[model samples]
Target: MQVAIDGPAGAGKSTIAKKLAAVYGMTYLDTGAMYRCIAHCVLNQGGNFENTDDIIRIAEKAAITFDGDRVFCNNKEVTEEIRTPLVSRHTSDVACIREVRELLVRQQKAYAKDHAVVMDGRDIGSVVLPDADFKFFLDADVLERARRRKKELDERGIVKSLEKIAQEINQRDDNDRNREEGPLIQMADAIVIDTTGKSIEQVCDAMRKYIDGAKA
Candidate 1:
């Protein structure tokens, strides 16, 4: 079974998906981290982000894996490394390539084939797992999303200007939505949840109710 959660940044997809996977005893896949892994390689190897071919090459050569909460690249632990400010700036670019998305999406689907998995990202519902057992599109006000992202960064000890983070959030949202191939969009059947004021448990509880009732 596949439960897909598609949403923009900081809408609590990662937090909710991880918890939901634990609840269902399913594998948790973070597709955003896959993009971050590619971006990390592009920047670390001095590859030009503007060169789509070069970025794709780096992505192909890079080995990305999620063993529970840990993210690895080329058999090395990069769980914390890719979440840096540098990777954040370049990840959008890396994710925009058609070839890269195709590559990663294929791998994600392959992993979900033999087991129940909860995968979360921008295009998971529309592109990666259209036949998912349950789909959700989580959204909140732009201000709320930015605030959540800022809080996360602050807690991680990554100091960044609020104005800059807000601008980047808007830019990424626009890019992800407007991209020609596999843009970030909600499937028509998706359950839309406005998580602006909801606690994590509240969100999970609602989803759990949906899952249990549907499978009952």
Candidate 2:
């Protein structure tokens, strides 16, 4: 079983994807983390984001893998490193490159071939797993999404103004939607869930109903 969830950042894609994966006994693949891995790689190497060739080269040579919730890039654990604000700001730089997305998408597709996976990202449903058994597009108000992101960062001891975070999210939305490569999009067949005022449990339970009904 393959489940593809697509949404902007902080729409609870990762959180809900993990929950659904566990409940259904499927592996959860955070495809956004894979792109972040490439971004983190470029930063560590002191490569320029504007240099698409350099970014692509870094992505080509980076080895990214996931173990449970931990993310590894080139054998180094970067679960936390990739989530830093710095990396988050630059992730779209690498993700927008055609070569970079192609490289990561290949890896994502290969993993699904071997495992019953629940994968989430900007382009998972539309590009990476177009024929997935289930496709969901999760959305929330921009301010609500920003609040969720701020909460996560606060828990990590990273403090940023809510206004600034909301601005960044808006920028990210534009980038994800406008990028030339595999962009973030909601497929017509996908189940669209507006999670503006919903709790994680609420969202998960709602999705479970759909899956359960299909199974029945």
Candidate 3:
């Protein structure tokens, strides 16, 4: 089984994907983290974002893997490192590179070919797993999404103004939707779920009903 969940940042795609993966006994692949891994690598190497060649070089050499919830890039654990606001802001830079997207998408596809996987990202449903057994597009109000991100950062003692976070999310939305390669788009066949005021359990249950009904 392959499940593709696509959405903008902080729409709870990773959280819901993980939950659904565990419930269905599937491997959860955080495709966003893979891009973040490349961004993180470039940041570490002091590579310029505008230098597409340098970014592609970093991406080609990036060996990203997931062990449960931990993310490893180039054999180094970056689970927490990639979640930083810095990496989050720069992920779209590397993700927009066509060569980088092609490289990572191949890896994502190979993983799904070998395992029953639940993958989430901006373009998973529309690009990476076009033939996925199940596809979902999760969305929420921009303000709500910002609040969700602020809460996560707060838990880690990383304080940031809600307004600022909202601004950044808006910027990210623009970048993701406008990017030339593997842009964030809702596939026509995807089940759209507006999680604006819903609990994770509620959202999960709603998606589960779709999958369960199909199975039955």
Q: Would you list the clashing residue pairs of candidate 2?
A: none
Runs with alpha carbons beyond 4 Å of true place in candidate 2: none
lDDT value, candidate 1, whole model: 0.91
- Model 3's TM-score against the true structure: 0.99
Ranking by lDDT: 3, 2, 1
Q: Please, what are the lDDT tens digits per residue for candidate 2 over residues 37-134?
A: 98899999999999999998888899988889999989999999999999999999888999888888898898899999999999998899999999
> Each candidate's TM vs. the true structure?
0.97, 0.99, 0.99
lDDT of each: 0.91, 0.94, 0.94
lDDT of 3 by residue, 1-216 (tens): 999999888888999999999999999998998999999999999999999999998888888877899989888999999999999999999999999999999988988899999999999988889999999999999999999999999999999999999999999999999999999999999999999999999999999999999999
Query: Which whole-number lDDT from 0 to 100 does residue 135 have in model 1?
Result: 98
Candidate 1 vs. true structure, TM-score: 0.97
Prediction 2 TM-score vs. true: 0.99
Cα RMSD to the true fold for all candidates? 1.0, 0.6, 0.6
